[model samples]
Target: MKEAENRACEVMLHAGLLPQLATMETIAAAAGPVLEPFVQYLLRHISTPRGVDGVSPFELNAALANALIEGEEALTGLVSLAVSIVPLAPAAATTNSSSLTAATSGGVCSVSSLTRVRLTLHPAYPLNLIATDSFLNLHTMLWTLSLQLQWVAQSLIAARVCLWKESQSQKRSGTDNNTTFSTTTAPSTRAVQQEMLHLVHAVRQHMLTHVENTSVRMRRGIATCGSLREMQKQCGEYEEELRHGCLLHDTSSSQLGSRKWHNHNDGPAASASGSPELHSSLLEVLESSLRHCILLGHARQAKILINKAKQAQLEAEDAEQEALALDSLEFAKQKFSQITCAVAATEREFEGHRVAFMERVSVYGSEAGAHSDAARALLAAVDIQGRWQPQKGT
Candidate 1:
């Protein structure tokens, strides 16, 4: 919901519309005119999990979906949250004894409860597997979720660029009605972008941690379960099994049911991503972010062109209006003479315009220099991300 709202906000920005109230309902109303008080009344009492924490709603959804794949419930492709509990660790038990006693007796406010982990279980995995399979599998899908979201972002931004360019072309050719556009970037635009990027990187850090942890867990599981006599090629196959909710097998000349799951720590991605288990999750995230930024830059360029061309159209219209006042042949001949004289004015001003543009670029470096640098950095990163993938198989 947050991601979708942000994209809608950007589209509204592109269309010279500002989000009023800056609520989800305000920003996401780019699709059409929003019905007023009725819509407000309906959404007034609505709330979503972690909605106030600025956490991407995708995180919870993805976490839940990943949790589903670990057991029998996955066969039905259905799962729901089970009973939740707060288990006090031994260390906290003594410190919170009085509060624990009060809570056990009074059924309220336990100091120990606040300090302990809130255990949320799904039917797919039991509490026993929390330290083993469930923990490892829980956060792995975050990487996939981020990449897919970023891919969608890139597509939307690219679409904006195409639409803007096409509109500009039609306007310039006098084939469409012209609308005024602003070249100025919004003050809050960078804030929104940075906020989104921060959430993304937060997700990426979790992805990295889970990938490494899961690879270790997979290795231990493999060693204990006796999946095969040999250790080679287990990680890749195991990750595949995890993905498909299938039995772990020895892909190397035989099959063994010794282990229920396997790890692809040895798969071809990189040590950076821990295993093929990660599918180069970190790299994919970085690439997706970079791609999104590049597409945004393309859209911005198209927007700039749209705004700057308005000057030429205005000038042509003013010239045509002046020419329309020529009621006499004498007046017309004099106007024609003036037009002939001004024919070379554009050629003469070309160098001046180039110099002025260069000056503006220099000023841009000092003014919005941070934004420009960030954009260039993103583009450079995109280049790197694009360079590596083709050399190896995903």
Candidate 2:
């Protein structure tokens, strides 16, 4: 009997069940009388032989099945609780512990933690094999959980970029409508751009850390789980996908250049018109900002910014045209004033010459009257002729 008990303990230890059973014993002891019935039941089952007198084989099998179900439930609950607590744990924990915490908090899980968990569960292989359907279901659940966690981490980073872009856009909109020029907006815009660049860089760091950890885990899994060919392949594919997805290949600069070129050529007449050139340059800056937003995965905010920029460009063009028209009108008024002054000066000079000609004719008439009738008649004829004749220039 003693030999049989020793053998059972050895099997339980090998299966990694001894620690869990020991933990339960400790809890039961702490609870004292409250868990007495449960403790007694477990002890009785452990001590009882499979072929005891009146116990039917079928009944014995049923009890063992019940115990297995209960044990599975307990393990599942414990794992869930641990996962829930990890995010709230202090950051100074061991590397595996800290990584596990980060994973629960929507950050990458460490390769070491993943490997440890995988190896620790190896003792349950015999039980899992005995219940193939259940094992498959559990595997699927674990796979789904890991994928979901990874997605959550990615989404969290994307969300931060979106929020930052939106806030910067709001600040821009709050400025005076006439200040769309870079001279007015450049300093603030540059500050926001720098912030965004830093954020993207941080995201890249996180992604690299996650990818490296996943690669390490994959190598270890491949080395140890030789029979799990399909699983290893799937893991490899997932890791590759993550590496590609998380890589921050910045195409914003190129995209901005292309977009600016397109916008500059969008309207030849407008671009050629010097008055509206300011608006075109402003549009280029706005389009560049929009492209940056799009690259960072802030589609909704980018859309809003695009619409605002378009409206601002149109308004700027109108203002520039109005200014040009006002200048032309002022120039015309100045020319009209100069022409009027020159005409008044010519009229004054002609009036002065007419008065002098009248004075000379009166003097000649007085001198001719003193000479004779013939001379007077001659003088009167000359006066008539002078009055009838056209002026020298005419």
Model 1 lDDT, full chain set? 0.30
What are the TM-scores, per candidate, against the unseen true structure? 0.26, 0.21
Query: For model 1, how does the per-residue alpha-carbon lDDT over 1-394 read when each residue is reduced to its tens digit?
Result: 6566455434533432111111111111211132222222212211111111222334433443443343322221211332122343465445545563322121212111211112232322211222234322332232223333333343334434554665566557653232222222222333334433543444333333333444555555534332222222444443543332111111210011011111222223322222222222223333333333333443344344544444344555566643443233234334333332332232223223222222222222232322233223322332322321111223
Error of 2 at 342 (Å): 70
Cα lDDT of model 2 overall?
A: 0.32
- The candidate maximizing TM-score is 1
User: Model 2 RMSD to the real structure?
Assistant: 42.6
Which candidate wins on lDDT? 2
Candidate 2 lDDT, 1-394, residue by residue in tens: 6566456434533554333322222231212342233323322332222101223334433443454345523443221111111121244345434563332221222111211111012224322322233322233223222322232233334545654665676577763323221244334434445433333233334333444444455444433332333333634454333322232111221221222323322332211112122222322333232223322332343344444554555555577765655555444444334332332332233233223322322332233222222222322332333442212110
Poorly placed runs, candidate 1 (over 4 Å) = 1-78, 81-121, 124-139, 142-394
Summing lDDT over every window of 10 consecutive residues in candidate 2, give the lowest-scoring window.
Answer: 111-120
Error of 2 at 23 (Å): 16
